[model samples]
Target: MLEIKELRAGYGEAEILKGISLTVKPGEIHGIMGPNGHGKSTMSKILIGHPAYTVTGGGVTFNGKNLLEMPPEKRALEGMFLAYQYPVEIPGVNNAEFLRMAYNEKRKHEKLEPVDPLDFDELLNAKMKFLNMDSRFKERAVNEGFSGGEKKKNEILQMALLEPKVAILDEIDSGLDIDALKVVAEGVNKLAGPGNSLLIITHYPRILQYIKPHHVHVLIRGNIVRSGGMDLAEELETTGYDSYLKGK
Candidate 1:
């Protein structure tokens, strides 16, 4: 449901993503594995309209809408979610309150009435149970005092609640232990279904073992040099990105 063509973007005076192109069809999970400093994360930020990067060329369309023209908040309300590699902390903001506001905002976009707090608590509780998170998390401030693994789990919880049509998870496996990684991967797998798509970017392919991708892409120097099925990830796991850099 997301189409990106010749997408070029970067900070002023320096371009990181040069002629990057990829497509994620509804219900399909796509994996992007690349070395550090490649345009994988840059392309993700640009897709969500992060102001630091300017779109110098190319275009992105989501579900037939011109995604580039929409602001970040609007893009999110339109069912685009990005789970950051480093989730930020929001002190003094109740986690449940933050999520309720975000969920209500999306509800407004869908022309539905806001959910009452009691109902919201119930819904949040259900999602928390699915992620194997304790209800105490809903009482604490967002990401504040959470361990590295906890922060990553919180990001996945947000993804579960938002239920974005096209979810871009940037390095969700980073800093996670094997147990935490499996839990996070299970959450993602549970969310995959019709009318939803996922773009999972990572440096390692271990996460793919839990959540199998329909397609795998190798991005090097801002271009997607190789595209194949899950076997590509297994190959990269054994061979690394060295061979992919040749002739690029």
Candidate 2:
């Protein structure tokens, strides 16, 4: 569902992603594990057109559409979902209203009518319950006072609602407890099926144990250096990332 070739992206005058080439097939969950500053997060940001990073070379095509050329909002409308490590908070807007507007906005782009409050509540509530989240969170302000774990759950809630073809999760396990992680991971697992792909950018192997990726790639110095199975993650946990550097 997503194909990236020789992608070079970075901040002004300083490249982070020297060149990244990866592909995510539909219904496959791919894991990207790397040491800090290896450009894993940079690749994720560039995929969605973050203004902070500029794509200097190569191409990104999602579901046969040009990604680098499209605007960020257009990327969202095109079924690319990103779950941020730190979700932003907008105090004035209530959570339900935020989700309502988002669901409708995407539909509007697809030439569909927005659902009414009663229908929105029914549809969104089912997903919230599926995630085992409290119903009261809908009435709260958007991340205004939510805890770190709650923000992550809210992100999963959005993912469940939006149903993107390619979902890129950046450091999703950060600050989450075992229970919260299970809930979040379970929600992702449920959402993983035909016509959907996940590219998870994470550090620890704990989340990988839950998600069970089909392919795992290790990134070193802004490049994908090693590709392996789930066993590679276990190996990394026991041996660390240094031995794999250079010719060992």
Candidate 3:
């Protein structure tokens, strides 16, 4: 469970999130829909503690712990995961090695023994299979020479392996085809269970078909202007944000 109260954050000289607050309860999926420049991406970045955006006001708490004070790595250690919109291609590090280090860090924090390379490989293989990733990708450099769909699937694989308590996906469907989208959605649904939650920040609605969200929030001009059930997505698809834009 995560609670954000009166959060105001933004890039240098530009305040994007204007006192926005939303709560993600356990086992629920919350969809965020908004037009460009509405601060949806900014909200995701700030939630994950990107250095570019400063939290000028308000507080973000996870399971009653203040998240605003934690660094990005600490945030990950606290069971917060973000599927970035544009995952970069890292050429030097093998995918398996990269994930193993990350997994061990999480384990280390929990006072659990880190998995050996062989054990880590077996665990990563299961997640790779869940995402239908090719065996060759395990040896390949992280995101290097991967197609858009492959990169997205790899991100999902990380999610499955990490099993964050609260996952934030920013523009996950971007550049994904129909088949890839379904795969990603299914991975999310499979990982999301009792005591786990997902926050999907996207401009499109098609991904909702695979992972039906319990609630949807409309963000505009750094504020959540409308909060409703899934039907709110349909209204936005048909009517556009002209009325909502004007009302604001």
Query: Could you give candidate 2's per-residue lDDT for residues 1-248 as a string of tens digits?
Result: 79999988788999888788998899999999987788888888998889988888889898898888899999998999999988999998999989999999988988999999899999988999999999988999998899999999999999998889899989999999999999999999999997899988988888999999999999887788889889988898888788756543
Kindly give the stretch of ten consecutive residues in candidate 1 with the minimal lDDT sum. Answer: 239-248
Please provide, for model 3 over 1-248, each residue's C-alpha lDDT reduced to its tens digit, 9 standing for 90 to 100: 89999999989999999999999999999999988899999998998899989999999999889998999999998999999888889999999999999999999999999999999988888888888778998889999999888888888888888889999888899999998898899888899898899999888877877788999999999999989998998787788888988884
How many collisions per candidate?
A: 0, 0, 0
Query: In candidate 1, what are the lDDT values of residues 1-248, reduced to their tens digit?
Result: 79999988998888998898888889999999999998889988998899999998999998899999999999999999999999899999999999999999999999999999999999999999999998989999999999989998888898999999999999999999999898999999999898899999999998888889999998899889999999999999899999877765
Assess every candidate by TM-score: 0.98, 0.97, 0.97
Q: lDDT for every model?
A: 0.92, 0.90, 0.90
Over 4 Å off, model 3: none
lDDT against true structure, model 3: 0.90
If ranked by TM-score, best first, what sequence of candidates would result? 1, 3, 2
What's the lDDT for candidate 2?
0.90
lDDT of 1 at 239: 94
